[model samples]
Target: MKKTITAALAVFGLVAFAQAEGDVARGEALSVTCSACHGTDGNSADAANPKLAGQNARYTFEQLLAFQTGDRVNAVMSGFAAPLSEQDMWDLAAFYEAQTGTVGEADAELVALGERIYRGGIVESGVAACIACHGPNGNGNAPAGFPRVSGQHAAYTAAQLYAFREGYRAAEPAADARMTDGESMMMRSVAYKMRDFEIEAVAAYIQGLH
Candidate 1:
């Protein structure tokens, strides 16, 4: 099973990877179950739930694959993702990506520190600027599959960052150990270096980013 999943991931052309893009209409139709946490339009109402709106389709699809294959360990997501076909994953990604993101209120107390961390990083600690990849507006790089962080829920972002820092996130298998698993490793390294306050502050800032 791991071999099959690994093969699919390697090519990005089997099962969920086969359909790189999907039908937005089909995705919308299939999102009924997701509406309880994420809104009908993919904007989540709760800060603890992630807002999928305007997220990169490829990145979203990768996550679905991770959840389905048990690489990522979220009980709620794993169950929902398990039954999804490649087309289903693709469609859901498309639907979420097509929706507009909803902005959350930022914690004013953390905004200044968060802004500095996000834009400049803690240079001495070797944390890199978020804008280098996430872009100036936090819209992210679509082709590179970096997710859009602008207007995401602060709590959700913080949780993910904490997960990465503490090694709760699943590690991607690298065909060559020498090769950095671009997305996964990059996030883990960054998160690992961030202090708890910096993580919270950055998440709060991202929540209100346009």
Candidate 2:
């Protein structure tokens, strides 16, 4: 079964990621401060930090914008994102997208549980399958702006999911509803419905997806 899943994922990769162009050299130069947390190669040494390696450029750019615009809030990220111009965001995204992410080992006991939630989901509870957007191997659907999840740190992933669940990504109270995108709402809806165990299990599954 696992072999079949792997075969299917390889085939899907051809169409899933739509690449973007940016100046890699400039991106590398601009990434000096980011290296403190994200590392020079986009792989953070800390499990709590997200690995930016092989991420979709547009997705990364959008996230940086989100941090800047307060669509997504994090004290540290907000400060880091404040000074960046739009071009800087794209360049940084390009550099990180060029790096490879490290795959993590899944806990033997949680592997099956994680796989179940990631692939099939808990329909009775209205939880959607992660694979629907993240793709079979966690490559993510770049054309649709979904970020890469495969090879991500479980701790980081779980934290984000929980944040969304708790309304961390909600638009500012005074902002127009139109400012909220459907994708963000969809993710928040899913997270809000998920149990703590589901978030942890799915995150574990994603770590080993590569």
Candidate 3:
């Protein structure tokens, strides 16, 4: 009995070690394919692609799953994610989250205006502060599954915000239903309330975040 128990414990230890190693090893390997769009360290060189560096692992994983399952429809990402397994999603998230993000510069006036809007919502317009969930520095919260908005491309950000407003993207079915409802409503409201100039200003501010 003693010998059997000892052997079982040893096996358990090995299994645990392997699991940890798998995450790291798989993350490294999977990152190679991602570099073309997400850059070497998760920053995208293409203005059309959003930067993924410093994004929450949960958020990144969910997005990957969405693309794989056809819940989120992006022509390019759908093809890429279709072949990934659950483990691949986890590993890719780990890799991207581990990288440091690049920051962009914003116009002074736009930054100032964006800062005010981000911190203080337009109450009359029913606009909510972007910082409430995205954090003061836009670093985002992992637990909340909020992707880091800091250091994103201004054009990409504006486009996405506009898309969300126009209902071009549908909510993920697997997303936390409770949070999704509130988030969806807030985003929709904010998008309608914002003008093109406001979107530009906000995007500029977001790009400059470190």
Query: What are the runs in model 1 whose C-alpha is more than 4 Å off?
Result: 1-19, 168-184
Each prediction's number of clashing residue pairs: 0, 0, 0
Q: How accurate is candidate 3 locally (lDDT)?
A: 0.70
Worst 10 residues of 2 by lDDT: 1-10
Q: Please provide, for model 2 over 16-116, each residue's C-alpha lDDT reduced to its tens digit, 9 standing for 90 to 100.
A: 32233566778888899999998889999899899999998778877777778776667788799999987788778878878898889887777898999
TM-score of candidate 1 versus the correct structure, residues matched by position:
0.85
lDDT by residue (30-55, candidate 3, tens digit) is 88988898888889999888898878
Task: State residue 95's C-alpha deviation in candidate 1, in Å.
Answer: 0.7
Task: List where candidate 2 sits over 4 angstroms from the true fold.
Answer: 1-21, 168-184
The CA lDDT at 202 in model 3 is 87
Encode model 1's per-residue lDDT on 71-177: one tens digit a residue.
Answer: 56677988999999988888888888888988877899999999998899989999988888899899998676678999988888888887776552544432111
RMSD (CA, Å), each prediction:
6.7, 8.3, 9.0
TM-score, each model? 0.85, 0.84, 0.80
Displacement of residue 145 (Cα, Å) in model 1 is 0.5
Best by TM-score: 1
